[model samples]
Target: MIFPTPEEYTVLVLSLKVGLLCVVISLPFAVLLGWVLARKNFRGKLILDGLCHLPLVLPPVVVGYLLLLLLGRRGFLGQILNDWFGLQIAFTWRGAVLAAAVVGFPLMLRAVRLAIESVDPRLERAARTLGANPLRAFFSITLRLAAPGVLVGSLLAFARSLGEFGATITFVSNIAGETRTLPLAIFTYINQPDGEAAAARLVLLSIILSLGALIASEAIARKMKT
Candidate 1:
């Protein structure tokens, strides 16, 4: 398409916002969990890892329903959040972010864990011998070397969020200017009478955005290797 309609622009901007927020909000946790899973051998570690990756195996609709049960307005934790912080996640843009984050988290965590695992443990220990503490060694050596994987994971999460649909729809209900991301917008257009043109535009936009991210990821990976 040459130019996007205002609605298309809004959907594009909202999708970008959700995708970026998903990565920002989830990255720290992914990094920590990845580090733990890669470096530690604690009790129930396998269970924890499985739980972290559960979203990957479960249906996206099921994941959204679970979130709704936990964070919906009348939900148990949702009630507490609403009463304490005036936060309402269900049927809102914030819920969209949460849904995208949950769905994308497993990919993020797996990439980070594999990346950290690829780093040599002896290098961390060697830093310890040179007066670096664990955190210092990790920040300076281990994490630095793992930057490529982290970049890849972040891009993967962002791409996943951009295309997220079932979970977002179930959790946020596809309100325009709120929860209507690109995928949701496309779904809306597809269902409306004589909306094929709009839907086609969105589908093309989705392909372009996803392809751009993939290309950027590949370029970054290549740069990191050299």
Candidate 2:
């Protein structure tokens, strides 16, 4: 019977929406990069790997700032978007998705890449020898085997996005019902007078949700293996 207030519900819903959107939008690229990193070795591979993982090491605020520089109104691509389509991603929900995606991308890529790498290369080669084309074998065997790892990565990304506060607030300015997600709402409550009780409730909820996601991810991984 422990439920958040109506306003807390809004924040919860918004966080889920943004997190799902982030995962959906980033799935394709994550797969492509995962495949390439796991199977191919080319010149500048290290550079590509570093770029994919840079967000993990950098501060979330720094990631948000870089996004602002690239997507803001006065930014390079931002100017093009503004002039051609009148589109603005900064300080918006879309920007929050972008922030979450940037921050969580490495985790997704790591999971998928490891899964792809763990598969036996000889199986793919054998399938090709058995008359399946490279593409066909890959789609049928490699991707199918890696599905579970990718699923785990996606859930991790979702959990990370749900808690995305620093980058989202930095890029989107914490507008209530717009950019203020669960974590941001929790922070707001903690800063207000006599707000500890509400903040404690939200903290418990956040922990529960995050732990549930991790457990689900592990279960899925096990199912995929069998």
Candidate 3:
């Protein structure tokens, strides 16, 4: 019956917030990219797919550094965003969300693409022939059939975001009560002489959260088949 200390609780909440936000922000884009990769055969399509999945193959630190270069305060896009909208992402929770989203996006995209590909294209064509526009046919037929995969992908991305470490730390560093998520908190604890107990607790919590997401994803996939 051990309760989480305030610090642990904060870390937990922040981690959940980041993970959920990452999923919500990235899901729509993943769905669009997945649909395109599965259904379209245009020039440079393979290149686009490879770029989308590059994060999966690259080192997390490299990904983070790239993000920093592209979004740092003085960076081209970062400067524009800061000047135009007064928005900042680096060294903040928002940065954490972005990092997690980028890293987990590949998994989300792959799951959705596979799911959509499995659906019969003819169903969408049939809908189109029935006077529905392409967008309507996709939403009503293709996307509906692929919903389970989308759900599963969301869960998988959530799980990945929860465990995100290298990229987050590299991009945002560790700021207590700010950008310090569960992984960062655990890392901090492990480095301290009296932090083992806290680290262990956080580790267990991380396991629980990640395991739950994975289990839920598997359950959804099974349900989709049946």
lDDT of 1 by residue, 85-149 (tens): 99999999999999999999999999999999999999999999999999999999999999899
* Model 2 TM-score, all chains together: 0.95
What C-alpha lDDT, on a 0 to 100 scale, does residue 161 get in candidate 3?
A: 93
Estimate the TM-score for candidate 1: 0.98
Candidate 1 wrong stretches, greater than 4 Å: none
Off by over 4 Å in 3: none
lDDT of candidates 1 onward, in order = 0.95, 0.90, 0.94
Residues 116-223 of candidate 3 have per-residue lDDT tens digits of 999999999999889999999999999999999999989989999999999999999899988999999999999999999889999999999999888988887788
Query: Residues 71-189, candidate 2, lDDT per residue (tens digit)?
Result: 99999998899899989899988899999999999989998899899889888998999999989999898888889988998998999898887788888878999888889988999
TM-scores, each model vs. reference: 0.98, 0.95, 0.97
- In the predicted model 2, the residue pairs found to clash are none
**Local error of candidate 1 at 61, Å?**
0.6
Task: Arrange candidates by TM-score, descending.
Answer: 1, 3, 2
